[model samples]
Target: MEKKELEYIHSFAEYVDRFIRLLIDYSPKLVSALIILFVGLYVIRFINRLVRKIMVKRELDPTLSKFLADSLLWALRVLLFVTFISKLGIETSSFVAILGAAGLAIGLSLQGSLSNFAGGMLIILFKPFRVGDTIEAQGVVGTVLEIQIFVTKLITGNNQTIFVPNGILSNGVIINYSMQGNRRADLVFSLSYDTNIKTAKDIVMQVMLNHPKVLKNPAPTVTVRDLTDSAIHLSIKPWAKNVDFGDMSSDILENCKEAFDAAGIVTQPFVREASKG
Candidate 1:
């Protein structure tokens, strides 16, 4: 029993000695790896800042600049991490293979998200629309709030926030109302058939000219669009700055009604669709 106990003690001591020797052998490499990691992190941060400054100086779009900076920072950090691990005498080839496999699995699982990311890249590159532009897409009309890697945000006329995936948004038709800086208001008004077409047109034109927001260069047009059984259809089209489009359109409509009433012009209900005989 005594002999057995001595053997166990000797075995324990040998294990401890081996562990200490291993630590002694690896200590410098581990310390060096830690230092490299810290230095790499600092360098990455500095590079990120430098890239951002360069992007700003070049007047690049904010969304694209941020995305590029973040992607670059992450890739550099990953490379630094691999270097650190390799310094510790770990075989990086196997590590990289495992990472590749894992990335493949993750990519397969997140196909939709990857597609959105690609779409975001396309949007940033092509610049179909920018932030703060009023756009109509995916059956929703809204102001562009934010453009993200995976999704784009919009604020509707009713102030509803919508998060649309970039993948779908990129594929669909986007109507950018503010792109041209000016928009035309297409309004139709109906009056009794007895009302003079020329007089009604003159009144509408006068109201449009009086409005400060309406543009005069393009000129406001008021003409007889159609002659219906119940009323005369007049088309009132005016051009205004995109920013003031909604307000100018509403004001023009209200002012036209007031002017018509003052001029003793009668409004009439007309059937939009004619019955088939």
Candidate 2:
């Protein structure tokens, strides 16, 4: 009986040894698959980082930077995931098809959002305006406070915050006031026709030259823009830094009035002609 028991144990051990050999023979394929997955994931992360660095170095806007980074990272992650799955002997074509169908559905549902995003890309690449720049678009005039993927925040002269869709802002005409670094301060002054036009012009020019904010290089211009029945029109064009626009405008007008008063030049007011007297 002892001899029979020994033989039984030897047979069981031989079966176990055969199973171990079979597993060892197949381990290389499993190890290769795991290695491929790990390497693919590492490459994806590295490529994503490289793309972000490149975009940031291009001096792109902050909002655009984030958008591009996320897009590139997502694309790389999807590619790595597909490669890893394929290494495990799984077909990726069906997975890709499903993802594509889902993406199409989501995109259709969020058409407005996608439009704004596309508009934002155009604005960023073209750079029509930037934050803190005063712009007039679609009849809305304000200083840009923030630029987002879908909307732009603007603070109007009256201190009200307005959110404008990027799609509309990008499609419409944009007039940027702060792009030139200086603004032309325009002032129109009218005097009685009896007043000497040349004298009035000299007084206006002198006032502009003496003002602190007026630029000296361009020189202020005082010209007769038009002649009205009741008044001689003088158009005063002064070049001033953007920061000094408000002060320079107010000072020029006030000084023109004072100088005209000192010179005894009487301002004239418009009068409508009586109809069919």
Q: Identify the leading candidate in terms of TM-score.
A: 1
**lDDT (CA) per prediction:** 0.90, 0.84
Best by the lDDT measure: 1
RMSD of 1: 3.4
User: What is candidate 2's lDDT per residue for 1-277, written digit by digit as tens?
Assistant: 6999999999999999999997798677668778987887788778778877887888778878888888877887777778777776689999999999999999999999888888888887788998889988988999999988889899998999999898888998898989999888766887898899899999999999999899997888989977877777788888898778888988888898889889999986531211211
Per-candidate TM-scores read 0.93, 0.76
Model 1 scores a TM of 0.93
List residue ranges in candidate 2 displaced over 4 A: 1-46, 84-91, 268-277
Q: Give lDDT tens digits, candidate 1, residues 110-157.
A: 999999999999988899999999998899999999999899999998
RMSD of each: 3.4, 7.7
Task: After the best TM-score superposition of candidate 1, give how far the Cα of residue 267 lies from its true spot, in angstroms.
Answer: 1.3
TM-score of 2: 0.76
> What's the lDDT of the predicted structure labeled candidate 1?
0.90
Separate clash counts for every candidate: 0, 0
